[model samples]
Target chain A: MTKLIVEVQDLWKSFYIRHNRNDSLKERFISLFDGRRRERREVFWALKGVNLEVAQGEMVGIIGPNGSGKSTLLRVIAGILRPTKGSVTVRGSVAPLIEIGVGFHPELTGQENIYLNASLYGLTRKEIDRIYDEVVEFSGLEDFIDVPVKNYSTGMYMRLGFAIAIQLDMDILLVDEVLAVGDEAFQRKCLAKMQEFKERGKTILFVSHALELVSELCDRAYLLVNGQVILEGVAREVVACYHRGQIPIRHE
Target chain B: MGSWMRGLTRIIRYRELVRNLVAKDLKVKYRGSVLGLLWSLLNPLAMIVVYSLAFQYILRIPLENYPLFLITGIIPWNFFSGAVIASSEAIIGNANLLKKVKFPLEILPFATILFNFVQLLFALLVFFPAVFWFKTGVTPLILLYLPVLALQFLFTLGVAFFLSSITPRYRDVRHLTEVALMVLFWLTPIIYSISMVPGKLQPLIKANPLTAFITVYQDIIYWGRLPSTEMLISMVLWTGLSLGVGYSLFRRRQRVFVEEL
Candidate 1:
């Protein structure tokens, strides 16, 4: 049996929605003296009782409509956001490609950015040196390696971002809609690389709106709605359930 | 591992990321400007000119080599103020990365402080030429500047970590820091000699944490002697207290930073 790589149990995350613009310290200081200076905040639950489990070497896609807490769930699993009332435990390191080119500076050269981005993912310089040529080659930005990234075309920019992200040595890679940026050929290359990773027994947690891609790439899928995991099963079955408008009844 | 050991290991592992981030900040700082890195030197030089003219020429201070005196205090002051001010916005400014990436939030402030430290090193390059040209009486005490610098760095790091954690929730912290720094600047003896202050005011001067650091710089760089025993002791105490308070506060508050942001 494949080992479980990610185990999230009954996750809940809430955010405060301030009713007034008095969140600033200056405003708070004034509110202390003025009787009429009242500030209010409402709690917003982004994720309510979310539970999920992904096995080792499985490509699990989280599908949900906009503002449905898919991204929040991914962020929590990646350890970026603390859950309000649940535990998200992953067995090993996570490389989060939530947004391409996260720490990329526009002024730096492509080579420089590749180093910076990889280092952010926790790759040592020696490890980066080993993978530098492969990343540059995969991005196909050989001629522009020395040129600053600001001058590169949008496609080149995304290609570089994707290349650096995919090359990191991680046990589980958390991907979130990053593949939507590049062109068709680049997307094909990315899919091929994903296939390679799957073959190498690396677990993948993918979040995307692309249903066809989900059914094609993922071994199993999760459907989330209104902050809860409404359905989970075989990839095509879950996709069909979502298409049939079979959102689970809201708990509240 | 113990919590402190865990923290130490985390920082040790992320040392490369810190180095790269620091390098990126330095490069981005001077990337598009015409004067580029030279502006780091020219900025403090301009401050010296203005302050020297205002105090030495206009106010008619009796002290000789007044510009040198001002530079001594000013250079280190710039490092402290620059790190503290930048750190207040460090986490808020990197909301994008904070929202997506799962790494130490403390790295943000640590990297920002280190960035300013690098710029201060460059500014120190300018100081050496001024020191040699003015013939500010070289001595063995200059070697002692390293220990003092390391202590100041710890104090600055502690404050940076604390401020960065707090700023996201208290957005006015950024503004308050600017005003506080301005007030603190005048309170510290950067532009004038400590002896010039009246005897009654000496104790007041001693109370300010920055006074010890600025005086240490003034001692080795200007007076060419070791810092007084009292100053050294206060430096260590202040460094320890600031680091202890700052780090604990930062640790307590870091978990909620993303939500606040």
Candidate 2:
């Protein structure tokens, strides 16, 4: 069997929703004296007991309705969010494209931001130097490499972000709705690059709302609803289940 | 011990990221201005002039070359205060990166401190000529400047770590730090000599962590003498205490930084 490169076991994550945010000292001090003025808070569970496993080289897609904890799952796997319960075991390094242009400083030139963004993934200067030309070529931003990214169009910005993520040498890639930003031609290029990534035996966990694309590109998929996985199987079948709007009764 | 070693290795592995962050700050800060680096000197220069007028001419403090004494103490003090103030924004300012990337969060505050340290080095470079002109020429004791500066950096870094970690939870931390620094400035012997303070208040002033650092700078650069053993011991102890408390607190709170932010 192929090695399980990413394994998430009964993972859970929660956030606090404050009705009255007393993050300042004055409010905290006043609240201490007046019981009625105490801030109200509610626990928000973004992910509930999620279990997932991905083998090396497999491309998996996660689909869910808005606010269904899809992006939260990817963030947790990327180690941006700590699990409230259970644990995640990732055997290989992860390049999270969770949000394109994440670490890009707008005041910095495109070339400078490329170095800064790549370093966020723990790449040394030498490694970035090696991949530098290829990333610029792939993004097709050769003309504006020296211009600050604040001046770049949204499409151009995402193209650079996508180029940097794909060009890096990492074992696992977590993509979260990044394809939605770029133009059609750039999106097509991205799809081709992802296909190439697959051919090169890299693992990918993709989160997207594009049903047809998920069906076509992923080998397997999971459908999540209200922070719980409702269906998991071959990509097409999961997409079919989602299309039918079927909600299976849970014994629990 | 094992976890500590792992943390060390992780920091070493991400040294490139630290370098990139420091570089980014420098570029962003100096990008548009033609006077870029000279601007860092202006604040300290203004302080030196104002204090020289008030204490040297107006109050008659009796210390010769008061501007020289002020330069040594004020420059390093500015570094400490500047770093501490900036640290409050370090983690919160990078909310986007913290939410999306998984690299060490500690680098954010650390890079802020280093950015201020770079400016301090520049200020020193600009003022060392003045020190030579005003004070009695070179002493071998001046060789101790780098080690004293190194200890000050670590102590400030510790304060930074502590402040940056807590600021996300308490948004008021930045204001509190500003107020605290205002109070600390007077308590530290920057404009006046330590000898000016009554002997009873001497111990109280010396108890401040910043006092040892500032006095050591004054001793080495202005007095042209080796620091007393007490000052040396205090310097080491403050660095150790700050780093130990600040880093452990940072480690404990870092896990929840994303959640808090």
Candidate 3:
């Protein structure tokens, strides 16, 4: 049996959106005496209670139609967000490549961002120095490394971001749709790297909409609908169910 | 360290976030500038030239070593106020990063104030030469202002963090900040000497915490005298209280920042 690395018990999250109001302060003041409208109302629950567990070295893919709480669940697992009402127990160091280059400074050079990104990922300067060459070489952008990242093309930016992320040595890696950003070759490279990570026994929680990638990479998968886990089983079976729901099958 | 404390300890625990944020701020600031970070010094110098032109050339406000007085007063005032304005928006501007990355909320405002302090240090390099040009005598008492400055920085940070945390919630607060800053500028004795204010007005200005702090600053740099014991107590107390309250508010609201953002 694989060692368990994460435990989730009935996680729930909701948001209180103070309703939007139009009309200026003056208009509101004028209407106040007549009671035109006082306070706005309502709350949105982005996630109902959600529960799941993934063992160490398991690559689990989470698929859902939009607003099915996939990203929210990923956020809670990464500890970037708090669940409204449940316990999410993560056992090891978790590195979330949630978004490509979320902290990249526009003016800083690629080399500078590498250090900043590495530091943000909990790596010390010395550790970044050790892996600096590997990061740049994998990024395939040695010539542009000195240039400010603002000068980088989308591909260059994604490459640098991916390079920084892939170098992070963490037990649990939460990958969002970052691999979907770059060119075909780069995407293939990212897939290969994820495969390499699998070989190295790093656990991954992959969230994406691509059925083929989900089936190919994830040993176990879940189909989420309306902020609830509607189905869970083998990846291919889940994908088959997901696609079947997408297009109606006529019975003879 | 204490139980009454709520948020500052949390910020201390995430010290890495603060360091990275400070670095990110410093890098992003001059990133687009052609002169790079020289922009910080250029701003104070430009202000000095314009103020000198107005006071010395046009109005002819005749006074001995007047340029020295203005530079000493204006540079710190600029640092303080610039930090206030910048810090008040620190968390709001980094809303995206705050929502995405789970770090201490105080890190954002701390980073803002820290970067401003760095720029203030740069501005000081330009400011010190004028002190000697005016031939002001250096006294041991002048060194006393370092602790005073450390206090003032803390106070500004506290106020900035407090204001920034609330500003995003009630956006009308941002519009009113300019007026508050203007009031603070006049109260702090930036453009004029403390002696110039009437004796009755002096007490009122002294009552303004920032003015009391600035008075300490000008005392050492201009008059070469140490600030009185009462002034020192006031400065330290103000920094402590503002930071205590400001950090608390920031800490309490931090978890909710993503939704607010």
Candidate 4:
């Protein structure tokens, strides 16, 4: 049996919403003296008691509607957002393709941005140098590499962003609705790359709204609504359930 | 202590990210300007001209070589103020990156401080020659400048971490920091000598953490003497306290920064 590379148990996250009419010093000072006029705040739970497990080399997909905590789940697993209660354990390094070009600076040239973007993903300078040529060649922007990224066409920009992420050979990859922004050819390339990672026995958890892509790429899929996993099973079966509208719209 | 060590190791491991971020900041700052990197030198030169004319000719201060006195204090003060001001928005300004990426949040403030630190070094190189021209002359005590500077950097880093972490919650912090820095500039003895103030008020002025730092800069750069033991002790105390307070506050608030943003 393949070992579990990712395990999340009883995960919970909440945010506090402050309700104050005035933030000015004078009002705050007055309110401090008048104990009756205190600022009010409300608590909001974005995710509640979420549990998930993915074995090594497994390809899993997460699907949900807007405000369904799909991205939140991915963010928690990627270690970007802390879970308020419960635990998340991952055995190896993770490469998060949640948002391409997250740290890319517009003023820097393509070559310069590649290094900065790669480093943001926890790649060492030496590691980036080792794969510099491959990343550049793969992006197919060799002639425009020296030009500032701000000047690149949107398609060229997306190509470079995807290329930098796919080059890093991390143990667990977390992808979040990123492939939807690229062209058909780029999407095809991304799908093929995911397939290659699967063949290499790397674990991947993808979040997407595209049901067909989830059905095609994921071995097993999870359906989340209102911050809880409503269904989990074989990818095709879960996709079918979602299409059949079994999960109703949740009222806040 | 174990957590602190882990934090240190994490930061050390990402030193290259720090270097690259600092480099990127410097590059972006001067990218579109006509003067480009020359502004780093020209900015202090302009301040010397403006402040000397205002303080010496207009106010008729008796201190000789007033420009040298001002340069030593002004350069270090600029570093502190620049870093602190940038700290106010370091986290908020990078909200998108913070939401998407999972690196240390302290890296933002660290990069902002180091950016100003690099500019401070350039300004110092320009000021060093003025030291000779003003006949302050170098002393063996000047070797102590580096250790003192490292201390100030730590203090600034700690303050940066604290302010950046809190600013997201208190949007007013950005404006508050600007006013606070302006107040702090005059509070320290940057424009006038501490002796110029009444002897009774000297201790009060010295109470400011930057008092010791500014005085030390003057001792090594202008007076050619070693900083007093009292001044050195105060510097170390402030540095340690700020780091302790800043790091703890930062660690506490960092987990919730994403939600707040």
Residue B183's C-alpha lDDT in candidate 3?
A: 83
| Candidate 4 chain A least-lDDT 10 residues | A20-29
Write one digit per residue (lDDT tens) for candidate 3, span A66-100.
Answer: 88788888889888888889899998887787887
> What value does the lDDT take at residue A137 in candidate 1?
96
| DockQ scores for all predicted structures | 0.73, 0.85, 0.33, 0.56
Give lDDT tens digits, candidate 4, residues B1-261: 886787887777777788888888888889889988778887678888999999999998888899999998988888999899988788998898889878877778888888889998888886778877977578888898888899999999989988988887777878888988888888899889877989898888899999999999888877877779999899999998998898899899998889878
* Model 3 DockQ (Cα-based): 0.33
Q: Per-residue lDDT for B202-231 in model 3, tens only?
A: 888877787777777778888778777877
Residue pairs with colliding backbones in model 1 are none
TM-score-sorted candidate list, best first: 2, 1, 4, 3
DockQ of 4: 0.56
lDDT by residue for model 2 over B143-195, one digit each (tens)? 89998889999899889889998998899989888999999999999888787
lDDT of candidate 1 vs native? Answer: 0.88
Across A58-139, the per-residue lDDT of candidate 2 in tens digits comes to: 9999998999899999988998888999899999899999889889999999999999999988889999999999999999
Say which prediction, candidate 2 or candidate 4, comes out ahead on TM-score. 2
Worst 10 residues of 1 chain B by lDDT: B1-10
Please identify model 1 stretches exceeding 4 Å from their true place: A34-37
Considering just chain B, what TM-score does every model have? 0.96, 0.97, 0.89, 0.96
The residue-by-residue lDDT of candidate 1 on B187-216, one tens digit each, is 898988887899999998889999999998
TM-score of chain B of 3: 0.89
Tens-digit per-residue lDDT, A1-252, candidate 1: 779999999999998887765768878889889857767779899998888899888999999899999998989999998888989999998988888887778899999999888877777889999999999999999999999898988888989988887788588989999888789999999999988988898999999999999988999999988888889899989998898888776666
Residue B80 CA error for candidate 4 (Å)? 0.9
- Judging by DockQ against the true structure, name the best candidate: 2
